[model samples]
Target chain A: MAPFAGYDMPISYPTGAVEEHNICRRGVGLFDIDHMGQLIVSGPDADAFVSHTVSGAVLDMKDGDARYSLLLDDKGLVLDDLFVYRLPGRWWIVVNASNLETDVEWFTLRAREWKGTVKVEDVSEATYMIAVQGPRALELLDLMGTPKASSCPRFTSGEIVIQGTKNLFGRTGYTGEDGGELFFPAQDALGLWEGFIKAGETHGIEVKAIGLAARDSLRFEAGMPLHGHEISPSINALEAGFKWACDFSKPDFVGKKALEAIAAAGVSRKLVGIEITGGVPREGYDVVSPSGEKIGTCVAGMFCPTTKKYAANAFVEPQFARPGTEVAVMAHGKPKSGVVVKRPLYLPAYRR
Target chain B: MKIDSAARYQASHEFARKDGTVFVIGISDHAQEALGDIVFVELPEVGKTFAKGQSFGVVESVKAASDLYMPISGTVTAVNDALGGDPALVNRDCYGLGWIAKVEATKAGEFEGLLDAAAYEKEAGKD
Candidate 1:
């Protein structure tokens, strides 16, 4: 166990971390996303408030729809990456687990700037989140009384009534699997978790309690970025491959001018995927050219069990962004060979 | 499943058995379990001198890397090269074939501060 934000998180079970990681990839696994913070932005200026605070176009979204977005600082550096879903009469924003307090403060201060009536309320303590991911995730969920096996659009959500509890369910996940993120009343979480595990047993689905350790490795394998690692207050959204999220065409938003300049000049450094051999490539490992010239730095990395290789994502000089660009990772005080590739190291086997 | 109550331990988890000037040094069973599956072990070269608690080498497990510290001030007299290929021996036989390095203690009083097997068993039992 390791200390993370005052909680004792298990890095690996006695069985092994490698096995735990593969279990999530090949079969269904349940994750306790209860640590993540949720907030409700409501009132007359709800749409306008979210539009101004986030990089995405939340103002244009209708109820029951979700959009991927980023919370940017005044200079347009990312403070947090989030998903905001428009609910009936309110907008629900899901912020990163470790950045709950910081995100709440960021949103609260911005809500005060709205010219119209808007109230930002933190509902994280009153709600709970559970992520069920894998190829059979929907099937097991169907057995639990979730309606419809049909696929929902990538960033959309649907409300479901399960076990007499109303759950706001979204067809989204970070594990690169066919799964859903469900938010329900906090009092119903333990019962819901037990029910899922018991029902998943006979279907040959494995139930494991995923912690931050496996979460990091699985997200790395799926090419998903974490807040502090890949996106930070000092990094721009364009260089981090979040350009699609920013809509400059819309009316004025935060840091639009800086982002326009970045897009026009082209990014000097770009985030690229790299596969390493000889040793594990961890965060902050120096990326160098064959001649030993430093070219970049690893933002996140892990030993990917599916491919049986060590992989990393680095923000390298633009000259090295193309696939097949050769680079060396300085590991254990030695140079190890690696090559830049596209993200999504493990292609999902899901039918979707 | 059994622990030798007479063996002594250092805070670094290395166990030392003193017989005159020579001391047999290996990691304790608790250390092996805490490290999980050991993948590689790097040992110090023979004739290297170290004060008590000096890091002698590194042990890489599948999950993490740990540094092996000397239990007592000593001069390295022999090294265990077999561990380079089969580091799992440390998990299987930490007190026997898993012995990492042998040393001739320069400070005989250093072993006095180490915990005997009974004391270590009590320490391990607490958690």
Candidate 2:
């Protein structure tokens, strides 16, 4: 276990990361991601308040709809990435654990700016998040879960009544799998954990608890962005190639002015996937040209079990972001030959 | 937590056991267990020489890369070539088939200076 965002979390179970990763890819796997934070946004003028905070256009989302959006600072750089959910009475946002307090305070300040009509509550302390991912995730969940889990539309929040307790879940995950991120009370953490395990057993599937190590590798291979890795305070959404997250048509949002100006001027750097051989590439490693001239920096790399290649995500000059472009990654003080490729190296079941 | 009683261990976790004129070198079972799944192993070429406690090669797991230290001054005699294709052997049989390399010891006295099974076991527990 290691300390992350003030929480001591498991890097992997005794079964190891490689096995845990493979299990999530093929069968069913569970991740105790309670370290993530949740918040409820509501009250009069909430639409205007949320619209002013996030880069995404959240007003049009129907109830139960969820959107992956960016929380940007006025300077047009990402402050955090969040999942904004449209509940019946309020907007439920899931933010990164490391930025929980800052995000809550940001919302509180923004609400105050609106004359205190908007309400922002920090519900993270009472929440628990479990990611159930793989091809058979919903099936495994439906065995004992209520409210017909599969009926939960993909990419949206759905309700599940567990022993009369209401839980919110979304058919979404960082790993490239057909699964849901289950959100419920922290007090029911044990019951939900054991329920999933028992359900997995009933289906003849081993529901292993995945750790942070495999969680990172799976996200890296799926072309998903991490807080400190891909999208940080210094890295803007456009530079990270998350243009879709930024809705330029939205009127009056934080960072909208700067982001629109950048879009008009075009992004300087681009993010791309690289398959490296001879060594493993890691965060902050230089991406160099054939002559060893520094071209970019690697964000993360790992052994991609699906592709059977050592894959990495790097931000490089736009000229080298094309697929099949030859590159090299400086790994362990040595340059390892690499080539740029399209991301999401392992295709997700939902996409297929 | 299993230890091969016949081998002597370096504090860095490499184990060396004298075999005729050569000494078989591999990481301890404790080290392999801590490393989780081993994905790649880089070993020194045969005939390369190193001083005691010097880094000879690298062993990579899914998590990170770690340097393998020489327990005693020796010249590389042979490297386990099968690791090139399947490095998980290190996780499965670290002391037997997973032996990293065979070395012709140049400073034989260094082996005796290393920790015995009982002492190494006690040290491993502390970690």
Q: Write the residue-wise lDDT of candidate 2 on A220-271 in tens digits.
A: 7788899988899999888898788877777788998888888898888998
Error of 2 at A306 (Å): 2.8
What is candidate 1's lDDT per residue for A1-352, written digit by digit as tens?
Answer: 7776555767776656656677787777688878788999998988877887788777678777888898887667888899999989999999986788999998888778875488989999899999988777787777775565235565688877778878888888888787788899999999988888888787777766666667777877777789888899878898898888887776867777778878888888988889976566778999999899999999877667677666888999999989999999997677889999877787654423
Taking chain B only, the TM-score of every model is 0.91, 0.98
TM-score of each: 0.80, 0.96
Tens-place lDDT per residue, model 1, B53-74, is 8888877665676888899898
Q: Of the native A-B interface contacts, what share survives in model 1?
A: 0.00
The Cα RMSD across the true interface for model 2 is 1.2
How many clashes (backbone N, Cα, C below 3 Å) per candidate?
A: 0, 0
Which runs in model 1 stand beyond 4 Å of their true positions? A6-8, A13-15, A59-62, A149-153, A348-352, B1-29, B36-63, B68-127
lDDT of 2: 0.89
Model-by-model lDDT, in order? 0.81, 0.89
Model 2 reproduces a share of the real contacts of 0.56
Docking class for candidate 1 = incorrect
The sequence of per-residue lDDT tens digits that candidate 2 reaches over residues B50-117 is 99999988888887899999998989999999887778899999998899999999889988899999
Q: Which residue pairs in candidate 2 have backbone atoms (N, alpha carbon, C) closer than 3 angstroms, thus clashing?
A: none
